[model samples]
Target: MRGAPTAAALTDRLTAQLRRRPVRAFWTALGLYAAVWWLAAVLTQLNLPLDAVEMLTWGREWQLAYWKHPPLPAWVLDLLYRLGGGSHAVLYLASPLFVALTFWAAWRLAGRILPAPLAALAVLPLVGIVYYGFTSPEFNHNVVQYPFFALLPLLLHRALAGTPASRGVAGRGPAGWSAVGRERDWLLLGLVGGLAVYAKYSTAPLLLAVALLLLCHPAGWRALAKRGPWLALGVFLLVAAPHAVALWTIDFLPLGTPAMRAAQAAGWVERLWYPAWFVAGQLVNCLGALLVLAALALPGRSEAGLGNPRSALGFDRFFVLWMLGLPLAIVLAYSLLAGQELETMWGAPYFALLGLAGLLLLPRAPSRRGLFAALGLAVLLVLAGLAGYLGKNLFEPLTSGRGMRAQFPGPALARALEAEWAQLSGGAPLPTLVGSFWLAGNAAAYGEQRPPVFIEGRPERSPWVDPAALAETGALLLWREDEAGRPPGWLAAWQGSLCPQGELVLAWQSWIELPPVRVAWATYGGRHCDRPPLAAR
Candidate 1:
């Protein structure tokens, strides 16, 4: 009997030792995330040109509802721009920081359910993928959204697993099992769900999925019959009310509105398809790899044995279905109901959640063959993605110039324009407009002037551009030829034959002199021609 007791104690000691083995997986994930962030920051800083910088700058000044996007990202960048004094280096730093944070959140979320090595391996595809590597820092909504999306799983874990007790009440149930009760969890779920909605209205469908999942749980029906879920519902409505009120007050409605309907009638499908393509395109990046792995790792319906089959379904299944399936469902439902095409950015939150879940699904004790397979696949995808990225950048002029100029290049253009403006106007303030809004925004910020005026063609169309206001300011006009087309009658009356001249040829009308000591000129591809004084001419 004494010998038996000693043998049992030895077994328990060994089990504890095995459990405490150092987690190399977490370190690997952290290292890979760091490397990816550094690479993206370096590349963005080095390769982005004047045009991209101009876009970011422009986005800041004309901070309103863009033709294709909401203004939150532009708003964030504008804040950063002001804080950093328009330094591209400082703005560039935001992207990598967000990326690193996203990865850290994913790793933490994955660690809750998976071993360290598996979690690291799961995140590998995300960092290794080219799409996430290259596009994350392009001063777009997706960049800011990624970190928030990564945090979704963590929040859910806290709610479902009961980590932050301040948010909800932890309940003990039968069989020594502990969880957040249906009533309390629903309220927490609603609050988080509302946050996602505020982050991106397109993510609204996730709330429904969460509700459905809760209802499907064993104690779900009984709890729902009580007051908790309803209270949660009220909380959701309260939280979501502001965004609705803003949209209504601003008269800025989404695709379901009358204006949106008219816009949709005119090639809305084409717009919707591009976003779909963008989503598909990300698959070539690290995000795509993890998604594929998660799909593979999903437990089949049959594999969920009879003993509390719902519990067996796991968070991975719920997450995938909620994140991936819900987006698709929303798109399909909207298309069917409202005949509106789905926007690509609408799926961003879902993809981020999928990335987290996929990493958690990595095998704890992968077979040698499985390990070899995963590595081979990862290498193959990376090479393919790199080759594609390089080919596009090298051979395709449009693709190469697209993201690069908007994010980094605009600053260079701003400096050059400032120098040109100084020489022509002698440091006097003048109104100017560049071809693209992005360019104009940068010029206004970096050029040596305050309140650079944009000429309004249709005063009613955009509040930022007011014809009456520009006329009152006595602003000089600067425009790109491609953008100028035929100047409005008022503009043409103001200056005859004032179109762009010389090798630069920015637009039909380049610059105008409002009066003495005030001059403006627009440049094309960084080239601007100096004009003799108006009296001299």
Candidate 2:
């Protein structure tokens, strides 16, 4: 009998197999990513992220924009949640969908510059990317921007890089075809770019990058002279017009909100230190991708210089450079000047094209086995991440006695409160909920009929709420028991004066038992919601 296959032989065989089936393997990897991450979301999280909860409440009502961020994400969540029969598990699907779009767009862009197989392999590092992996289950504004970021560059790249004929792609179209292609590309760019802005104002940085490139780069200025760009502008304005009108007429500016509860630093040391720290954090986030690329370079069975970035086949270096580099530079400069505290997640979309960047610039090109190994490394990273996440959320709560937000029994709390409200008020979704966004928002999301949260009773914060109607219609108020005296001063004055209901302590939904979460509920409007129109009784 043949000797048992050696480790080296098995590895070679697997790599050879991967090499032959790169496109299939590429798709398989993406599918695996989406499936397992969704699994993790279902298994690990109970309460969605604060952003997700906020969206859950806002999503109930549609608009071009919310008081905070764009409305596209909310629109998506609303449709997805309703489609899934109000099950929050479906919310997890959005993250995977956004990430897959980002990767697919990046893949298509890469294919233009690299071989089809290598293009597939180029995006393998994305699996190991932190934002795309460990923290991906949360569907929020940052998550929503992923596809827009990828597509923005891809559309711009295609528009600027010229058509199949112009790029020497084996066929020439009829005369004026290139001009038509450019206009078509511009039209698509306008559509994607417009939606991107509608997703978040943060898109300004990239748009600014494009503007700067157009102003300063030779290739960029030439493109601006074409009528295609003006057409793009008109399209963009048309898309933004609704929101722009809203902003212009709205009483309060929604651009900036209250400061974060986190501490800010001052003095020269902090200014310099904070920006540097932000940059360093980004690099650390990118460490996994770097390691994957480094691994690809580690010998075995790969060719060197795959897809030569130096190829004369029309890869707009300036377009790629500006798109990839400027947004981060703008952020870094802002942080340095403003001493703005940077949350790593804020950079979520900055590196959507990182895999493409590595493929373009990294000196070594992996042989098929090398590429396979890199993808394997990416799979390992994801599995290890998922395992750790599951373990932490499931087991660690037992020792800590306090569960993370993911451990909060959101649906259970909503169920209990709704039952009490129905018995008292003859059945409705409790009208509305007030108090902290966390508790009230959670109740609003899961409560019968999915009521809305007043969000601290601030009309601007919750423009959907008519204060006069809220006062007259009344709302059931909720706050976490542990945060007794923490309500806003005005809300606190009423906490004492309003109908003070008792507390409900519910055990966290984790493995084994952890300390139960205590939530206090009360009603405002008149009596216990059974009696009608009076004032806070």
- For all candidates in order, the CA lDDT equals 0.48, 0.73
Which residue pairs overlap in candidate 2's backbone? 302-367, 303-367
Tens-digit lDDT string for candidate 2 (1-537): 899986557656645544577567668868877888888888778778777888878888786666767788888889999999988888889999899989999888877677665678678788777888877787887888888777877877666564433345423433433532478888888888788876777778887776676567654566777787778778888887888877766642656632352236677788788778877888888888888887776666445434444452444444556687899889878777776677766788888888777767655457556665675677688887788778776777676767888878888888888888877777754687887777888887877678877887777778888867755787777775334555455365454435666687887777676668877777787445443222344
At residue 116, candidate 1 shows an lDDT of: 43
Model 1: lDDT equals 0.48
Best by lDDT: 2
Tens-place lDDT per residue, model 1, 1-537, is 345545335434322332453245445435665555455454434434343343454454554443334555556656676798855566666665666767677766655545444444445556554535545555565566666555655554444553122112334222332444445555765676665554445554655655665567533454556566677778788876775665665566443332353334246665565445545644534454664464434443321111121221254445444654665566556554554444444454455545445543443343333334455555566556555544444434343433333232333545555555556657655454523344455456555453443423333223465545543433434443333454334343445324343222121111221111112443222223344432334
Q: What is the alpha-carbon lDDT for the whole of candidate 2? A: 0.73
Looking at model 1, report the run of 10 residues with the lowest lDDT sum: 508-517
User: RMSD of each candidate?
Assistant: 10.2, 3.6
